[model samples]
Target: MVVAAVLASGLLLAGPALRRRYPVAWWLLCGFPVVAFRVVHTWRPLMAGCGLAVSRRPALTVVSGLVGKGAPPPQPRVPRRGLIRPTAGGFVLLVRLLPGQVPEHFVKAAPAMAENWQVHAVRVTSWKPGIVRIVASAADPLTDPRIPKQRGPGHLLRVTVGALETGAAWVVDLRRIPHWLIVGATRSGKSTLINALVAGLAPQAVALVGIDCKGGMELSLYEPRLSALATNREQAVRLLAALVDLTLDRMTLCRVARVRNIWGLADKERPVPVVVIVDEIAELFLVASRSEKDEAHAAGTALIRLAQLGAALGVFLVVAGQRVGSDLGPGVTALRAQLGGRVCHRVADPGTAEMALGDLNPDALKAAQAIAPEQAGTAVLASGDGWERARSHLITEAEAEAVAAEYAHLTPVLSELHVEAL
Candidate 1:
């Protein structure tokens, strides 16, 4: 008995440390069963308490048909529950909602469910008709997300940057959704995310073109792997125009090959894919004087054209900026519509977050707005599918620079894009 007591006390003392070191193990061995039991035990009452339970009674059965001799009214019917499945960071269950109950009902009750389950958050998503999937995380996955190992070969135009709130990998698949708009304030991990993205793409056989109008302050680190680098607004304009010309050339190639897009062409005949990284996009749009207005307009038109036709012509855009608002120009709004993928980090103003996610998902806008300054890499990303909180893995400038240098030999020489020579 004394030995058992000593062992129990030791485990009690080491519980937190073990949980911190091995969260998945601790959750599976210690937390899952308890949480599972709580979910099953309280589900009925919890549903009824949240007003999700529906009464089963006929309108004609008033006053129980007897003052004191009638049987007690039947309890409300709760939603049917499915098997509770455990995940790496949490658990998921399916619920067949009662009649008149929509997925929105469950979504509205997610906070209550989380509170009762003593979990960090609960997400309710429509799994099928009349069925909703509830995913509950025991803790915040973004606190210290584990980075997945780099594999030998990855899918083309796809990079796994970090982990999502659902504990799944946060991937940016440029092929699936070509253009991206990344907006974040200074030190909010905007640059870090770009570094991770570029580092992931560095080893791939893709032509990287950079237009950093900040005089090569940020993107110059990847100069080794880039086919073209434009530093000033003047050079950016020339480089963008050159890219437009290159796309037109590719379009002609596709037309002659009888292919719809570049991807449909034979691999041997396909031109190397081009990824344009535009850092500080506001620099290309903001006009200082009347003389620069036409220059800004030209830059904006070039970007809009790229965003319109780049995805089909083997050119993709990753546009990042500290601040992006409609007040910048109507061109900003037009460009925003073309970029389907948005990652909004902690922004200095609500307008940036709105510009990034408002049209896509209002809830995502709220989530992005809630990102604290301390949560640097944490962002709210939204596409046509939905929105979720995610964090990008940290990739320092030196690491990105090294990766660029390591893949310098793979850089495709596109003579047409040599803006410096032009």
Candidate 2:
């Protein structure tokens, strides 16, 4: 321990680069003994605040043994015998799994841990097979947004959202999941998320499509970047129908060329990849008038078909809704099934949270529903993997418009297809 401490101190005192390069070793050596012996016993009150430990059993001291009983035992020291890691946002309590305690036990006690640790929040995840790691944040990292860069594969999508509670940068790769479901309340930063996606994807070699059923108030400004935009039920139906036709054409093109998907085709022969963003998805199913019911159904069916088969043929979906529920109408549930990636912000009800999280640990649902108004851009996101707390960058309408104008020339003309609709 002395040697490690000496080496760590020397290296860290020597240079910043060395400290950055060997941070883990430095922190482990510099912190282990000090934290384990010096701080553990002193923080007894704070440790027990999480209700994870019991008071120490009173020892039969000489006076106690003689008197048959004594006043009481001193408080128990915390049993967190492991490493103390100073991460970006706060500290990580990493310990080997105890005999009867699982990672869930710590996770279940996160709220208390956060309060006792005097942190903004806390999350517990299994670092490895037999390790439990509790990450606590001194400040809410989501409050500080992260701007995404326009780089990555033409087909592969990566959007830099917010940071994790551990202060690690959070990004979602749409190529891996192919589609996403974003559920949030009206002021829950759904528009900001779409802006982030557009900002990142505009400069890439892909086509952007928008279905802004809210009278195009959300996405019409990006007309310079979007290959197509649908604002009403009739327009949406025609636009989705055209996309369906385009998807079928791509499939036939792939078969004729003896390839499986768009990626398998030679770059020169491939068509432009497509990413469709649907804002206020509930509007498509709201059929206000009896005369428009058929159009609404057709639009929903076409959109569902796109979700079902678009991924393999160089297409992706980013569907957002204020409230995603069965009450939205028929086919809502089926359409949701295709969305492998899920992002949930502060929802008005528990069911919206449930639809976004879907059988995830109940903790995630609770977390989503519990999102306070102070954290507008923050959200709970789940994909094929697990979930994380994320936030979209503050890309306003003006910034998005500038980006669209900058990349407007790159927007290709689809002469063969009806450009007015799709």
Best by lDDT: 1
Scored against the true structure, residue 380 in model 2 reaches a CA lDDT of 87
- Deviation in Å, model 1, residue 23 alpha carbon: 2.2
- Scored by TM-score, the top model is 1
lDDT (Cα, tens digit) per residue for candidate 1, span 1-422: 99988866876788799898988888886788889999999999999999999877764563555445687777778999999999988899999988888999899999999999999999998999999999999989899998897774488889989889988889999999999999999999899999989988987889999999999999999999999999999999999999989999999999999999999998899999999999999999899898578888999999999999999999999999999999899999999999999999999999999999999988889889999999999999999998999999999877987888888999999998998687
Worst 10 residues of 2 by lDDT: 30-39
Which digits, one per residue and each the tens of the lDDT, describe model 2 over residues 242-339?
88988999999999999888889998999888898999888888877886788777878987899988988988999998998888776788888888
Question: Which portions of model 2 show Cα errors greater than 4 Å?
Answer: 1-82, 127-129, 146-156, 289-291, 416-422
What residue runs in model 1 are displaced by over 4 Å at the alpha carbon? 1-18, 58-62, 65-70
Global lDDT for candidate 1?
0.92
Give TM per candidate.
Answer: 0.94, 0.79
Each model's lDDT comes to: 0.92, 0.75
